[model samples]
Target: MRYNYPHANLEFAVEALNISDESTLSSEDFATMMPRIQSLALRTKQWVTVIGGSRQVIQQLVNAGVSRSRIRWVAGRDADQREWATEQALLAGTSSVVLSFLDALSSPRVAQRLKMASKVSQTHSFVFRSLPSQSPLH
Candidate 1:
């Protein structure tokens, strides 16, 4: 697996990668694999988001080394908020991956706008979804 380790202290996005973490590596060694978290999840994209993911899921990913700096963690405080954040990030030309559980709540109108934005900005978007949500709609 690959990883992306952008400098947190730097003013600009400096893309860096580490391609391998051997079998003998320890938990501390995984810090070396932190960028691997991003590269594996993000691919050619620049960011990853946990859209409508429960708080626990978001926390676990962070504990597992997906840099908090690289994630736009969304708890669905509301659907509009998540969609707005997505739109803003896409407008800023951030290539992004979304781990979405609220598939039905996605805004097609917002998505259409994002489609235009992505085309204009030349960005990439990917969504990794498996289990669906059971939470009652508000």
Candidate 2:
């Protein structure tokens, strides 16, 4: 699959997809997988938000052809960081966001805030509710 950027001198060519053994793969391998995934994202023309995940995963998506303008990385942290990240994510209408550690959002109020951000963003968004780490507080 090849995707031309919506507006700009950018394009992505993608092929091959392997859903198995993703964790075991090295960083280099992940880099190779990125383009394929990004092609799918481009085809959808929707904002992709990754919540509760790692910066590495988000970076991989960027490498795969996902535009920075269409990505946001958010992880439920404390009140201030969460609010700041949420605001930034919403402002970035077409960017993918990585919201890591969903458990950090222990308040209903925070959840409501996230819901509002989702509603206002006019692009495709994705949320990663979990990551490789586990917290006792959660």
Candidate 3:
């Protein structure tokens, strides 16, 4: 679903991208979404933190027109660390947007914590997950 950025305050907005497999995120999947992401970064001119993203993915953002200096690519040692980093980034108010790549949210409390942190800091958070196919035949 599309989120209205202008009215994003205090809202737990989520946008999911469909992928061929639930275990991996392909370059093509991210490439397709680059334009929108790039536009948001450029328009806002704010720092963006990417948690658990690869070097290639970060390069793609730079190649897509986002300033390399404005992007912070974080590689957490583990899932828990990644979640912690995401929360800290939001709560610290150092980034205007935080993109997290995870297999799945560990728990509802995690989501609640993220939402509350985003709300308090007024930072936009986007969580990208590789969900199992919804098709019954899959």
**Per-residue lDDT of candidate 2, residues 52-134 (tens digit):** 45777777677677776676555655545655565466556554322333324445565555555544443322332334443
- Per-residue CA lDDT of candidate 3, range 24-81, in tens? 3443456676777776667577798999877776888889888899999888887898
* Ranked candidates, highest TM-score first: 3, 1, 2
The TM-score, computed over Cα atoms with residue i paired to residue i, of candidate 1 is 0.46
- lDDT (10s digit) by residue, model 1, range 26-123: 32433364455455554543666655555555666677656667777766566577566655655675544444433332545655664555444444
Ranking by lDDT: 3, 1, 2
The alpha-carbon root-mean-square deviation between model 3 and the true structure, to one decimal in Å, is 8.2
Global lDDT of each candidate: 0.48, 0.47, 0.69
* CA deviation > 4 Å runs, candidate 3: 1-29, 130-138
Better of 1 and 2 by TM-score: 1
For candidate 1, the 10 contiguous residues with the lowest summed lDDT are 15-24
Best by lDDT: 3
List the candidates' TM-scores in order.
0.46, 0.43, 0.69
lDDT for residue 80 in candidate 3, whole number 0-100: 90
Worst 10 residues of 2 by lDDT: 12-21
Q: Would you give me the overall lDDT of model 1?
A: 0.48
